[model samples]
Target chain A: AQSVTQPDIHITVSEGASLELRCNYSYGATPYLFWYVQSPGQGLQLLLKYFSGDTLVQGIKGFEAEFKRSQSSFNLRKPSVHWSDAAEYFCAVGPLRAGNMLTFGGGTRLMVKP
Target chain B: DTAVSQTPKYLVTQMGNDKSIKCEQNLGHDTMYWYKQDSKKFLKIMFSYNNKELIINETVPNRFSPKSPDKAHLNLHINSLELGDSAVYFCASSQSNEQFFGPGTRLTVL
Candidate 1:
C-alpha cells in the first residue's frame, strides 16, 4: 500500500529562521508529490507539487519543495520563517494511476516563536 | 470567489440523526472528492467522483453516501450519525492533479 510519512510531529522555529519539514513516502512507482499547509481553522492550501522534470519546485507564499527519488522524500523548505507561517503541513503522494486521490501524511505542526 | 465551498461550516447534531453536507465547486473541475479529518487531524479520502460518476470509494461505512448531482456538486449524506463520526469534512475539486480545497465543515455529534 502507498503511504506518506511525516517524521516530525511538531517543529518549533524562531521567527526569521530557516525551516525544513521532512517527508517520506512509499510507492511502487514514481508518484505525484505535493505539500499542503493548513492554517488555524482554515482549509488546506497547496504549497507546491512535483510531477516530473524539475527536482525543485517553487510554490505560492515563498515556499519550495525538493523531490528526491533516491530517498523517496519530498521535503518542504523556507528561507525565512514568518510568524504567520505557523501552521500544520501535510505531505501527500498520489500514484500516477490513482487519478487525483491523495494519501496524506499525519502532518507536521509548526510553531513559530517570537 | 471561493473555488470550492461547503455548506454548514459547523454542525452539532445528536447521535442517530441524519444530516447532509453540500459541496460545490466553481472551478469547473471534472473530479470532486470528500475527505474526513478526525480529531487527531488525520486526513483521509472517503469518496471521489469524476464527472458525476463514482470513481473511488474507500472503506467508508455504508451509512455514509455521496451524491453528485452534477460535476460541479457533490454532497455527502450521513445516516445514524455516531459520536465517532465527529470530525471535520473537506470538499475538494481538481482538473487533473492539483486539487483545491474548501473551508471544511466541522461536524460534532453529541
Candidate 2:
C-alpha cells in the first residue's frame, strides 16, 4: 500500500532556530511528493511538491524539501522558525497522472516558543 | 475569488437523517475531489470527478453519493447518516498535479 509517514507527531523549537520535519513514503514507483500546511480551523495549503528532476524542491513560506529516493524520504526543512510558522504539517505522495489523490501522513505539529 | 469553496462550514445533524454538502470551484480545473478527515485526523480520498466523469472512487460506503452537475461543481449527499459519519469533508480542484483545496465542511452527526 502506498503511504506517507511522519515519524514525529510534535516538535517544539525556539523562534529563530532551524527546523526539520521528517517524512518517509512507501510506494512502488517513483513518487510524487508534496508538503502541505494546515492552520487551526483552516484548510490544507500546499507548500511544495516534488515531481521529477532536481531532488531539492523549494516551496512557499521559505520552506524546502529534498527528495532522497534511495532512502524513501522527503523531509521538510527551514533555516529559521517564526512564531507564525507554528502549524500542522503533512507529507503526501501521489501518482503523476492519476487525478493526484494524495496519500497523506499523520502530520507533524510544530510549536514555536517565542 | 475563492479557488475552491464548500457550503455549510459546519453541519450539525442527527443520525438517520439525510444531508448534502455542496462544493464549487472557480478555477476552471478539470478534476474535482472529495476527501474525508476522520476524528484521528487521517485524510482519505472518497471520490474524484474529472470533467463530469467519475475518475476515482475509493472504498467508501454506498450511503454516501457524490454528484457532479457540471465540471465546476460536485455535491456529496449522505443518506441515513450515522454517528461515525461525523468528520470534516474537504473539496478540492486540480488542473495537472497541483490540487487546490477548499476550506472544508465539518459534519457533526449526533
lDDT of 1 by residue, A7-96 (tens): 999999999999999999999999999999999999999999998998999999899999999999999999999999999999999877
lDDT of 2: 0.94
For model 2, the stretches where C-alpha displacement exceeds 4 angstroms are none
Return the clash pairs for model 1, or none: none
TM-score of 1: 0.98
* Colliding residue pairs in candidate 2: none
Q: Residues A1-114, candidate 2: write the lDDT tens digits.
A: 899999999999999999999999999999889999999889999999999999999999999999999999999999999999999999999886857688899999999998
Model 1: CAPRI class: medium
* Stretch of 10 with least lDDT, candidate 2 chain B: B36-45
